[model samples]
Every structure is written in C-alpha cells, then in structure tokens.
Target: MEHYHDRRLVEQTWGSSNAYTGSNYTDYPYFPTLAKQLLPNLRCVQVVEWAPMSDNVYNDGWDLKLKTPDGDGAATAAVASSQLADTSLDCMFVYFDAVDLAGHSSGFSPQNPSYMQALENVDVHVGTVLNALYARPNYANENWLILVITDHGGIGTGHGGITYEERHIWWIGSGSAVAKQQITGPDPGTYNLLGTGIFNQSGVDQAKLKQSPVQADIAVTALHHLIYETGINPETYPFWVGLDGKSWLSQFSGVDKDMERNNIKVFPNPTTGIVTAWFENPTNDHVTATMLDVSGKVVAQHNECSSTNKITLDVSGQPKGMYVLQIKIGEQLLTRKVELK
Candidate 1:
C-alpha cells in the first residue's frame, strides 16, 4: 500500500482527480471536511492527514492551507513502506501535494522546466522510498501489489469534473500474482458480457471473489483480499464487491478441458472425426446445434430440427483439436466444447 499525504493540492495530472474521486464518492471519489471514513475492527489503524499547519491540520472553512511539499510527506511514506516487512498491513496512504502545485503554478509546466518538471521533482522523492523498499531483503517476490489511477483531469491540463475525458484512468499490476496477458476489451462505467466473456483471466478466483465496475470500489476490494490473506478479518467485507481477480496459481492448474465445457458436454474429447454431444436433461422439442472454432465462426450447424429433443453430432471428419458447440434450448443459449483429435 503506497500512501501519501495531501494527495490533492499536488502538482500532477492525477492528484486533483484522485482527490476529487476520494472526496466525492460515498466510499471514494468524494470525501468531505473532517472528512475521513474508517471502519471498526480489533486491529489498530491510524488516520493521518498532512498540512503545513500543525494545529488542527484538517482545519478550514474551505480556506487555503500552507504548502509543505518538501517535508515529512515523502519521508513519512518511505519510512512507512520500510516498516511493512515487520508489520501486517500497517497500511499507509500518503500524498506529496508538491507535484499538483507545481503542475498548476509553474509557467513552463509539463514541458520546458515547466509545471511537469516540478512534478518530476516528486519522482526523486518517490525514488528514494522505492529504492529503500527494493533493498529490503524480505521484500523480493513478496507479492506486493501496485496500482495507480487518475480520478479526474485538471482544467486546461489538470483534473476535476465528471466528463469521460476527466474520468479516464490508468491501471497496472506487478507481481507473480498477475496474468501474463494484458486485458483491454472491457470499457469503464457499466456493461456486462455474459457468455461472450471467456473468463476472469486476470489471476483472481471467482468462487472467492466479486468485481464491481466502479473504480472507487477497488480499494475496499484490495484491502479485503490482503487482510483476509494475512489472517485478519477486516471491519468491512468489500464495500463494492469481492475480488474479480483470479489467482495466478489457477493457471498452473492448467486449462481444464471439461471444466470449461459446462452443462452441455461433449465426450471423446480430442476425438479424431465423429464426436458425440449431449445436452443435460435435453428437451423433446426441436433444437438447433452449432459447431464453431474458438473464434465463434459456425463451422457446422443444425437449424430447426424436426424435433426439439436433440441431435447427435458427427465430427469424425474434422481435424483433431478443439471446437465450440452451441445449442439453442428455447430462448436460452448453451455452449460446450468438442475435440477433434
């Protein structure tokens, strides 16, 4: 968990966006004054916010606070990360508000010794912290997770507001726990693709997981997985959903030919030529059966049979390999796998 202080009021494209998202959403993407959300539990958790003002650091009638981008914000985060090896969670979320400021105020910003340049300065601070963590002997292959996102973009060049352009964010994960291939098909916001989906391939298991489309929900989901794995029951189950993530170990289990076959099963998998297909508790009414390659191209099909009950598929002439079998049981769509080998 990488925590920073005064995350907003920083000098980066994402600072304002992340802040706005955190402050706006009930859970995240929105947080108001006095404004912090905490859960009840047995483990000790501490809440800390940073500001130049020492007295009542969270004070303000929406007033401007002093900018102390150069101090404990970065150092505290680094120190906290080093302590992770010795502690369980001891979670920390810190923000060095300096970059956000530099991004907005600097005249030459982002390009020429400009605002972007000042933002780069924060990298120096981040480097020191990251280097220390990497050096810790206990940290290698620790399954450490990393995520970065921009909630809303700034005006002219920053983040705020609810436009798609503003809401666009980036996500990445690093660890032996991640999937080998990157996923890019699904769009943000709301949408669901049922059978059209292949599976949750990102290396998190479903029987033990749930996923929500809302970005704000990720934090709760992550903490739940982490805390639970660490032998601690978090105060909250996931605020939005369980992990849509899959376990990398699931891959080592390898591809389950029948595991993916589902209710409509085909026998003599890897059969050369004729293969038999059956529907579990099939109907007597006329049904349509289709055979397709993994790409969904219907290489074979039976339309409006005289009877809805079922039909035997003769795949003996086909080459040895894999194929998709689709059946129309009334309005319901069912699919199974067939082997030609």
Candidate 2:
C-alpha cells in the first residue's frame, strides 16, 4: 500500500471532472481488500506499513512490526534488513510511505528534483532488504518470489485522480520464476498484487495463469496453494460471488507461451452494445474467450469455432466500467481491456 488517502480524498483533491473511479479503501467484513481476505489463511505473515501517518502496527493481524523512532524509509528498511533473515517467516508485506510523503511535500512529477531524490532513497532501502534476503542461510533452496509494487502514483503534486500519471503504475516480479523478458499488457491495477502473491506461493504452471489476478482471485489461489502443499481442505469456505481465479492457473509446473501480439484485434472498444473480435489467421485449434469484471467476476464468455474467424460478443446488459477480455488459443493466451459504455 502507498498512501493512506482513500479513493474519494484523492479524487476530491485532484479530479478535474465529475466522473472518477479511483481505488477503493480497505473495508473489512463487507467489501474486504486483499490483505483482509488472505491474511487469515496464511500463517506467520509479517506486515510493516511504515511512515508515521499510515502506521498499521496496531493492527492485530501482523506477526511483526518495526517501530522506527525517526519514522523514515531508512529506519523502516533497516528494521526489515535486520529481520528478513528469519527463516520461519512464510510471507511478508513491506510498505514504504516515504516516497509518497516526499511527493506530497514537494511534487510528484518526475521532473521534480525532490521526487527523484525520494525515489533514489527508496532504491537504496530496497537494496538493503535484498541483500538480507540473499544472505539468508536457506536462500539457495528457498523458492522466493520477490515483487515490488506501489498502490498508485502521484500526478503533479498529489494523486488519487483518474489521470494516467495517477492510475497507471508498474509492478516488478523478480525471482527464479519470473520471466526474463518484459511482461506487457493492459493496466492490471493494484488489486492484482494479492493474487500475484498467492500465485507465487502456489507451484501452479504459468500456462494456466491466464489473466492477471484480482482481489477474490487471491483467496481462491490461496486455497489452491493449501491443497497443493498440505492436503487439508476447508469444508465451509468464505462465500464469495465473484470468479474463482485459481481456475486460470495451469496444473503443471512451467511457464506458458507469451501472447502473440497483433494476432488478435478488438474493435468498437468503449462499446455500447456489440463488440467484434477478429483473429488474424484462421486456425483449427479451439479458442476460448472469457470476460472478467474489475472484481474478478466473469461477465461473459464464448468459445470460437472453426466456422468463422470473427467472434461477436454482447455486453449491452453489463454495467459500464472496465473489463478484461482474455482470448485463449490452446495453451497460449492474450488479454485486452474492454470498456463498456
């Protein structure tokens, strides 16, 4: 997580128009976020949300919290670097809020000298934590999946708006599992971080991991990891109406072929009713098309036939928002963002 500012506050501070779809806040027992859903299932998950403004140490869920007297990125990183050698910890979530604070005080634009300095500071702290991880005794044998991500980016001096500078952010996953090449696709959103963690814990094959994971997908993936590692199964699980994200992961243990760009075309995006998908070349292999909403719920689906190269999908009845379109031709899959207007 980046700043503690909720969606509304960010929009109110930065939005120039009436319409806004900023990230939602963490609400428990109602509209729970990823951390709220995944923590209970995981054992000994460490969490440190430093920066005095967004201190989450008081929360009962965290196994460990670093109390920094200075409340800066250096102090937080020092604590994490010293404590990461503990082999007993299964999962950890470390959030450095210093960069965000720096942006708020100075400016968020990359041209801002202070902003660049703040990022450099973050890099140094991150290096310290990485050094600790590499120095671990079980580092060679451990299947570590290191992911670096931020909740959102700032625009101008602040954030929380729908602008590309604010909403569009990047995530880095480096380890024995991550692909060496650059992973490119539509904006996956911050909610996918939880699902990525669960996917890493699961030794599932990458070929099966089709679209990016959503909040609900994290819970389903965690369930799959539990079943894969330990034979224990929960009889009555949390009742979630959204999609079962785990179904997208492959059962085997290997990466799938990357999506062939320019092979699939979607027309009349931001569509009001009907949308058309055209495949570049006719193939005998079966092609499956699945549409998922922002909440990771399947709204529509279709399987392409050899009868024609063009596939038509109707989303007139669905609500107006962003949706993910996944086209799977055999083991290969490609994703697109569809806006229903």
The local lDDT score (0 to 100) that residue 13 gets in candidate 1 is 22
lDDT of 2: 0.53
lDDT of 1 by residue, 1-341 (tens): 11122334221222223332232221222111111212212122222234432232332212222223354246555554555444334233334655555545653233536556555665675566556556656666455544333333344454443344444455444434545655453453321212221222233233322322234333432353343332222221122122223222223223331222245666667667665566653555557777766433566777765654445667666655677666766655565556676
RMSD of 1: 19.0
lDDT of each: 0.41, 0.53
Predicted model with the maximum TM-score: 2
- Candidates' TM-scores? 0.41, 0.49
Q: Model 1 — which ten-residue stretch has the worst lDDT?
A: 30-39
Which parts of model 1 are misplaced by more than 4 Å?
1-78, 85-90, 107-109, 163-165, 189-214, 228-341
Please give the TM-score that candidate 1 achieves against the real structure.
Answer: 0.41
Among the numbered candidates, top lDDT falls to: 2
TM-score for candidate 2: 0.49
lDDT of 2 by residue, 198-239 (tens): 213233333433454323333333333333232112111222
Model 2, position 264: C-alpha lDDT score = 77
